[model samples]
Target: MRLATFVAFLAISTTASPVEKRADAFGIDISSHQGSNIKWSTLKSHGISFAYVKATEGRNYVNPYFKNHYDGAKKAGLLHGPFHFARPSASSGSAQASYFISHGGSWSADGHTLPGALDLEGGCAGLTKSAMVSWIKSFSSQYHSSEKRYPVLYITTNWWKSCTGNSAAFGSSHPLWLASWASSMGPLPAGWRSAAIWQYSKETGSTPGDQDRVSGGSAALKKLALGH
Candidate 1:
């Protein structure tokens, strides 16, 4: 995440503004399998303000790729956070919350970085709508809001509807990180407009993981994640 590398990544900038113009914000998601390594220079150069690195899963599984990326993100001076890939088959939401706390590195202890994220997708296939909402609530409630008010809720557009048909069940207070790979942010399903961070694509060049296709990369993103 070197500043020089970030500059190189920004060399191919499109017509979009360096900062986003709309209400939402943008960032990238990284995992262990992406293979490409991230450097602070890259993040700085590309104007990347924040990132979410894969942390751990269920009970025993941990993402081997998290440490370096997490370290690099912090070094680059970006607001860094970790996410857990929810495993719906093996454990209850309460159990998953316990596992996430045990394995997901200490963000509060290290620094008041961005809140933790729940990467819910196909992996969370077994839970009913009630169960899914309960799982989210169980995990989010553990983190004292006095410390970090809202933990992130990461989910796809359609999956969110099917999983939490009643968005009200999720409590409107928490901010969302919606993942929609479509060309435009339009067609964003109901109950997601409250999202503070919208992952529009996987095409980001700064972070060495999925290149998120994003709408804008403005300072607003920095404010949302870094609390500037």
Candidate 2:
């Protein structure tokens, strides 16, 4: 289906309602690594406002569940975005970018859904710090432009310090989506001054899948996705 029509369908289905008094808002992230079938309808009905669906990993292979969750997220009227799982084995970041494009260039389009993300965590597996940062730069540079904003760099505090200690590598311009998973949004890591989204916990909700707890609500996430 056309992207415009798909988005319009989402808008119509996502009729805003009176904000119910609640203690907090929630979001979910699905990926191939976490093998579980998601009931998008159930999530939506249960007040899920946003979701991050894994798109691709390494230089080959898109997430098998990507399209399913992508369409499901749209159908559920959730603010949606795609994230790439950075592979330490990959030769270059541009190679990873090429892989991502081949998997889903829809993310490259301006003003569409949420900004793409780079899932940067875990051990180097073999790559050096310079190689890892080079990959990051290549990936970021691919989408870096006045017209096209670079994807948010998704990283844990320790991972950032170990992999890319240089804050200036990403500069101050790119939006950061830090994964702290702390009790509260306390003092962030050395390089990170602010975060667009704070992934607070892996244990959340009365749902089945391993979900991530976030600080913002549906409205806040929707604003981020639509750039409003």
Best by TM-score: 1
Against the true structure, whose lDDT is highest?
A: 2
Q: How high a TM-score does candidate 2 get?
A: 0.76
Every candidate's CA RMSD: 4.4, 7.3
lDDT of 1 by residue, 192-227 (tens): 555566676554456433433323444544444554
Residue by residue across 26-136, what tens digits does model 2's lDDT show? 566777644445566766666566788889888776888788888888777776788888886755777676677667533533333777778887776576778777778
Per-candidate TM-scores read 0.77, 0.76
Residue pairs in candidate 2 whose N, alpha carbon or C atoms collide under 3 angstroms: none
Candidate 1 lDDT score relative to the true structure? 0.63
C-alpha lDDT values of all predictions: 0.63, 0.65
In angstroms, the error of model 1 at 150 is 3.0
